[model samples]
Target chain A: MKILIVGGGKVIYFLCRTFVSKGYIVTVINRDHDECVRLSRRLKVTVVHGDGSDPQILEEAGAFTANAILAITPNDEDNLVICQLADLQFHIPRTLALVNDPDNEEVFRQLGIKTALSTTYILSSLIEQRASFDEITNLIPVGEGKVNVMELLLNENSPVVGQTLRDIAMPENSLVAVILRDDETIVPRGATVLQSADRLIVMTLPENYSQVLKKLTGESE
Target chain B: MSSDLRYFVIIVGCGRLGSYIANKLSHSGHSVVVIDSRESAFNALSSEYSGFRLEGDATEFDVLKQAKTDQADVLIATTHEDNVNVMVAQVAKKLFHVPRVMARVFDLKREKVYHHLGIETVSPTLIAGDVFLESITTSPIAKREGIGL
Candidate 1:
C-alpha cells in the first residue's frame, strides 16, 4: 500500500518509520526544510519540502498514486484542506485528518472528510472511562466506536460468579468471547461455568456496554 | 433604500481587503460582522463603518457560528493566507449554507480548485499579472500625436 503523509513533527518521523518497516511505500510532505532533511536522513521514504496544504506540493509528493492520505498538521484548517484536496482532486481511497479541536470532529465528517480522529477526545474519554470503571481492565473501540472489545475482570462481588454461562443473561449483541482462568485459556460455551477471578474477553455493541458491565459486576452505572 | 433589500454580510479576516469591504458594505446600509484573530486588526475599520467587530480566529467553527453565518446573505473570506481563505469559505458554503461565498486566494492555480468546489474566488495575483502583461504588450495609443516631438 502506498501512503501519503502531510505535515511534519515528531509524529511524522514515527509514522514514517513504522509504515516503512511494515513494507508500505510512504511519502511525506513538510514545510520545514530542516525537518524534511532530518526525516529523509532517518527514514526510507520520499520527502517533499513545502506547504502540505498546497496542491502543487501534494502533487509533488505523489498524492495521485497514494492509496491513503494522512493529514496531521498542527493546524486543523490546514489538515482539513489537505484531506479535502486528497479526496476531491486525487481521488484517494482513504483520507484521514487529525482534528485538533474535539468539536470539529463532527464538522469534518459533515464536510465529507473520512476518519477524522481527535486525539483529545479519545484521550479524555479513555481517562473518564478508566476512572469510572475499575473492573474493566481494557476497553478498545472498534468499527468507528459502534462496537467495543472489553476485558472484564470478575471477582466474588460479581453477580454472575456462581452462575453457569447458560444461566447468565448477557445483553443483546454481547457475548463472552473468551475466559482466562489461572493457567487455562478457554473459549466460553453455554455449558461453561462462570467463576470468580476469571478474566472475560467480552465483545459488545457500544450501546450494550453498560448493560453488560451491570450484568457482570451487579452494579449499575 | 428599503430595509428588506439590506444584506447580512459576514467578513472573515480584517485585513486591508476585508476591512475595506466591511466598511463599504456597512456604509451601504448592510448589516456586517467582521472577524479577526488579532484585536488590533479591527483598527483598520473606519469610524464611519457601523458594524460588529468580532475578535477570534475565523477558521474556528464556533467563531463563525457566533457570527451567525447561517443567517448571512454573503460570506467573504479575505484572510491573507490562501489556505485559511479556502477553508473558511468552504465551511460557510457547505456547513452554514450561506447564499453567497467568496474568498481571496493569492495562488492563481488554486482559483480553479475553489471554482470547482462552487465557491467564488478573486485572485489578486492573477489580476495583477494580467494588468502587468497588458501594460508591456499594449503600446500607448498616440491619441493626440506626441506634443513634445
Candidate 2:
C-alpha cells in the first residue's frame, strides 16, 4: 500500500517509521524546507517540500497513486483542503485528517473525509473504555486531559434522534445543557425529543464522558 | 439599487483586499459584518465604513454562528490564504446555506477546484496579469496618466 502524508511532526515521524517497517511505500509532504531535508535524510520515505494543498505539489508527491492520504496539518482548514484535494481531485481511495480542533472533526466528516482523528475526542473515548470496568474512569482522569464541555452534532442517521430524553440512557455524570437547532438554543428537558442536525452542548464528567458520547452518537462507533 | 435593497453581507478576513471590499460594501448601504482573527486587521477599514467587526477565526463554526452567517444574503471570503477562503466559502455555502458565496483565490488553478465545488471565485493573479498587460501595451503617453481606464 502506498501512503501519502501531508505535514510532518512527531506523528508523521512515528507513522513513517511504522509504515516503512510494514513494507508500505510512504511519501511525506512538508512545508518547512529544513524539516523536509531532515525527514528525507533520516527516514527511508520520500519527502516533498511544498504547500501540500496545491495540486501541483500533491501531484509531484504522487498523490494520485496513493492508497491513502493523511492530512495532519495543525490548521483544521489546511487539513480539510489537503483531504479535499486528495479525495476529489486525485480520487485517493481513503482520506484521513488529524483535526486539532474537536469541533472540526464532524465538519471534516461531513465534507467527505473517510477518517478524522481528534486527540481530545480520542482521549475521552479511551478513558471511557478503561473506566467502563469501574463504571466511570473519569473520576481518576480518563486519559491525559480533562474535557468538561463539548459540542456534538446529531446526524440524521442517529438512532437516538427523535427519542425523548427520558427514554435514553444518559450517563450519570453528563448533562445535555443546550441544544442548538436552526439558530435556536433549546433548554432541553426529560420530555424533549432529540432531532437530527441538532448541536448539543454537553457538560460531562471525565469518568462518564465516553458512555454519554456513545449514547448520543452511536453511529461513530 | 433602491435604499431598501441593502444586502446582509458577511465578509471573512480583513486583509488588503478584504478591507477594500468591506469598505465599498458598507458605503453602498449594505449590512456588512467583517471577521478577522487578529483585532489589528480591523483597523484597515476606512473611517466612512460602518460595518460590524468580529474578532475571531472565520472558518470556525462558532465564529460563523456568532457573525450570524446563516442570515447572510451573501458571503465574501478574502483571507490572504486561498485554503482558508475556500474552507470558509464551503462552510457558508454548504453548512449555513448562504445564498451566494465567493472567495478570492491567489492561485488560478486552485480557483478551478473551488468552482467545481460550486463556489464563485475571483483570482487576483489572473486579474493582475490582465492589468499588467494592459498597462504595458498602452502608449508611452498614457503611462503619464494615472490608470488605463
lDDT digits (tens) for residues B1-149 of candidate 1: 57569999999999899999999999989999999999999999999999999999887889999999999999999999888888888889989999899989887755555667787889898899999999868977557776795
Off by over 4 Å in 2: A125-221, B135-149
Alpha carbon lDDT of residue B6, candidate 1? 94
lDDT of 1 by residue, A1-221 (tens): 99999878788899999999999999999888998899999889999999887789889889889999999998888888888888888889999999888878878888788799888877776666667778888877766567888898998998899888999988899999999999999998898999999999999987888888899989887
Q: Give TM-score values for chain A, per-prediction.
A: 0.84, 0.60
Q: What is the lDDT of residue A166 in candidate 2?
A: 92
How many pairs in model 2 have backbone atoms within 3 A of each other, for residues 3 or more apart or on separate chains, i.e. clashes? Answer: 2
lDDT of 2 by residue, A1-221 (tens): 99999987888999999999999999999999999999999999999999999999999999878999989888889999898888888999999888877777777777777687787777766565444332222322222235566667788767789999899888786888888899898999999999998888887775666678678877322
TM-score on B-chain, cand. 1: 0.87
lDDT of 2 at A147: 51
Task: For residue A42, give model 2's deviation from the true position in Å.
Answer: 1.5
